[model samples]
Target: MTDTSERPRADLRRAPERYLSRPEEGIETRHAFSFSGHYDPKNTHFGALLACNEETLAAGAGFDEHRHRDTEILTWVVEGALAHRDSDGHAGVVRPGMVQHLSAGSGVSHTERNIGGAEGPVRFVQMWLQPDAFDAEPAYGLRRVDPAQGGLTLLASGMARDEDGEALRLRRSDAALWLVRAGAWQPLPELPSAPFRYAHLTAGSVGYRTVPGPQGGGRSMAPGDSVRITGAAFADPVAGEDGAELLLWEMHSPVSYG
Candidate 1:
């Protein structure tokens, strides 16, 4: 028998689109974890993250104004533009390559509509996480990302040092989100022995290695597929036949759900 101590252990899971949300609506939504009416104890969350939903809006259909509290909401546009209006006096349109972050601290109400551009329907991914400090002020912000930028870009972070280069800031001090467009090998930051990393392939396919050494395994990813990395660091991923588009999040483990 092989020795158990000879290798490092990591959990690599593939989250399919149909696993977490109702797929029957015109405004299609496929959740990656427990959300709304779909609940799975074992699939609730990872680290400090609570929800990641892949959403597509019909020509004129969209979510009416909704309310949230004590949550950090991030909306990453994938296809068309998303018209967003919030109670914080911020009304804007988020387009592809742009990521919007809304802190529903204390409490806030917002609306997302496809009112899509000439491009047609609107597609995007929304993630929610608990803020380290609850009942704080509500806030909203956005950032533009370019695939040619190379390497992983820190779109949002809870890191104490502002010099870390993430400007779309987070009120929570326990999580960060990154965006990477991998055409070639682009390695990730060094991770601790026991780390919590969530890698989502929003577009194109990706070939990723989730651990530090050769003993670790890799997977071919498709759009909407994601992997949860634990106890190991994910190396730079390589793009498949088509280049890859991704959203990566690193957070403190035993995810806190709000």
Candidate 2:
């Protein structure tokens, strides 16, 4: 028995204003939790997730080759395109409706560029998660999920066959990710619905509540805002007000209790 006690509850309409916003000349980012210069020891992680960063890059702007180790990095492109180059000899372009997953098992270096000139800016949401396994190998994969796949598309899964042949595999076996575009109300996929779950609004506004109760009041979530579900629950997205988009992660935490 460890780290247990509080009865499962839920938090909703959690504004993004409390998050750390890092802005630069060409890049502007709003971090969902403590990161870079922002530090909040108590708010370090949610489930198996660590960081959720909303990044916007000006045309011809980008991130230089940076290093990462023992992290499962997943990126969802919201607009325009991103040029990616990594140490594993994988180079490609990721656009809207596409997902870019990079698994830095032992270590890896990569770069991301908007490639779009001053005419267009690129927007994307990137999430970092702790892998279940460590120091395995560096790998990378990409997939473009269309609405045809379903309202909820499996972007990345650590569990084998969790994606039905259309998802990217993560080196870590503790997490699964889903992305939803605005349209018909959709049910959550079958995953470990833990006491805590993370829901991020990538674009537009959405209607969400808890699995059994009205946690969010079935209210709306503005773009850039997110919620933390404290009970075993899944949300049904009923509508997408102005091109809505969502990213949901379901996983078991390394820390457990009796």
Which tens-of-lDDT digit does each residue in 92-112 have in candidate 2? 888888888888989999999
Per-prediction TM-score to the true structure, in the order listed:
0.85, 0.85
lDDT of each: 0.74, 0.73
Q: Please, what are the lDDT tens digits per residue for candidate 1 over residues 30-68?
A: 777778777787677777778888888877778888999
The alpha-carbon root-mean-square deviation between model 2 and the true structure, to one decimal in Å, is: 3.6
Model 1 residue runs over 4 Å out of place are 1-17, 20-25, 116-119, 146-149, 163-166, 184-194, 233-236
TM-score of structure candidate 1: 0.85
Q: In candidate 2, which residue pairs clash?
A: none
Q: Report the Cα lDDT for candidate 2.
A: 0.73
